[model samples]
Target: MSTEPDDIVARITEIVAAELGVPAEGLAPETDLRGIEGADSVRLLRVVAKVEQVWDVELDDADVFGVSSVADLSAVVASALQVKA
Candidate 1:
């Protein structure tokens, strides 16, 4: 898989949308995850879990906690993938 930043962001956007039961088209990299209509702690955690599964990388708890937007999550994922590589 391509570990390109743009590709990661696009994948993360889709994951976030699916986890939150929102339309993928409604989500952007800059979209605030917590501001989504159905975003709760549990659902957000599920998003994180899904991200980990898709990328085959474990994110730092600190990094996961600090993510506020899709782009932020993508950054964390990119970092994790880098460390894995």
Candidate 2:
């Protein structure tokens, strides 16, 4: 299954929001994941894990930790999917 960049961002926003216990509607593509009120290392990692699960791709540790905003993560996921393809 192929996921478009916008779809990746939306799904990731949902995952991050769920993990951080915030409303998904409150998140924007430019929103920094680390800046979220309840965001912590473990919670952010969970979001990464969920993204990996949903997309069935393994993101590099460097890429995962390097991402700050939802858009950044979406770009990384798009790159990973490209590599997989």
Candidate 3:
């Protein structure tokens, strides 16, 4: 996996955009997932699933539930990568 933050964020943004059908350009690291139109648990789970797939890391349900934005999830991903490393 790339260690660069921009690369990680870009890939994550793409994954989120594809899963949520939101415009990638409109999403920021702080954008609230729950506030997005049409966002639901199932769809949000799919986003988590996709992130796991991309990083090959399994996230805890508690961590997943507490995340409110991409930046939070990205931080979890970073921690997972550190542990995996």
Candidate 4:
């Protein structure tokens, strides 16, 4: 997979941190998104929506639902960016 830009990763991390109410530093690429303390389907989708706003990209629902970890979501965002580019 293509590596995402650092700025994109930072923005995504910020969105996740904000939506999930966790410190950005606590969100590693490998962190289990569903395992996070307050994460649920609705909250997760909200995070995805924030990412879409930040990156100006819409991700496939299939891809979003398939993501199990932050790395997976990052990859999906990176792919969406690539498509937009």
Using lDDT, give the best candidate's number: 1
lDDT of every model, 2 decimals: 0.92, 0.91, 0.86, 0.83
Clashes of each: 0, 0, 0, 0
lDDT of 2 by residue, 1-85 (tens): 4488878888888888889999999999999888999889999999899889999999999999999999999999999999998
**How many residue pairs clash in model 1?**
0
What is the C-alpha lDDT profile of model 1 across 10-70, one tens digit per residue?
8888888888999999998889999999999999999999999988889999999999999
Model 2 spans with C-alpha error above 4 angstroms:
none
Give lDDT tens digits, candidate 3, residues 1-85. Answer: 6745677777888888998898999899999988888789999999999989888999889999999998888888888888888
Model 1 residue runs over 4 Å out of place are none
Candidate 4 lDDT over 13-79, as tens digits, reads 7788889899999888778889998999899999988888777789999999999887788889888
Query: RMSD to the native, candidate 1?
Result: 0.8
TM-score of each: 0.96, 0.95, 0.93, 0.87
Please state the error at residue 14 of candidate 4 in Å.
1.4
What's the lDDT of the predicted structure labeled candidate 4?
0.83
Order of quality (TM-score):
1, 2, 3, 4
